[model samples]
Target: MARDYNFWVYIVTNEHESVLYVGMTNDLARRISEHRAGEIPGFTADYRCTKLIYYEHCTDVQDAIAREKQLKKWSRSKKVALIASLNPRWKDLAPEILGE
Candidate 1:
């Protein structure tokens, strides 16, 4: 049997650490790849925010969307706090996501 793929709400940050990008995706790897490759043109691509700083998984898409929306509305400090909770060093979580 195939394993179920969970949806995720994730945040990407730039090198200067001032900007943040919040988004949701079923395949975290593919989405991150798109961001890194600059395949999707927008704030993230323009700002070069390809570092996956934080993420939260959900079994339901609606929950993921709600969480993404909530995060998007948060202040930069609040977002940083959330990211720091799981990633104190604010490390790139992409490798973790890939189980590497």
Candidate 2:
């Protein structure tokens, strides 16, 4: 059986925590690849924020969008706390997501 495409709200950050990028996507891997490859010329690529520090899954795209907007409106410290809660060390979570 084919897998269903779930929506996701994710946060990426630079190594020094100087930059943060919040986004929503249906394909996390491809979106992360684009960021890594600098395919999208914007804040993330400019700051080299490719680390997948945090992400939340949603069954509905609208819900994901709402969450993304909510996160974007939060303070930097709150965002950091959210990330740290699930990823205290701020480690790259891509490997775990991909089961590598």
lDDT of 1 at 7: 97
- Per-residue alpha-carbon lDDT of model 1 for 1-100, expressed as tens digits? 8666699899998888889999999999999888888898989888998899998889888889999999999999999899888899999988877676
Candidate 2 per-residue C-alpha lDDT over 12-94 given as tens digits, one digit per residue, 9 for 90 to 100: 88778788899999999888878877788989888998788999999887899999999999999999899989999999987
Worst 10 residues of 1 by lDDT: 91-100
lDDT of 2 at 23: 97
* Residue 27, candidate 1: C-alpha displacement in angstroms: 0.5
Off by over 4 Å in 1: 1-5
**Residue-level lDDT for 29 in candidate 1:** 93
Against the hidden true structure, what lDDT does model 1 obtain? Answer: 0.89
lDDT, residue 85, candidate 1:
88
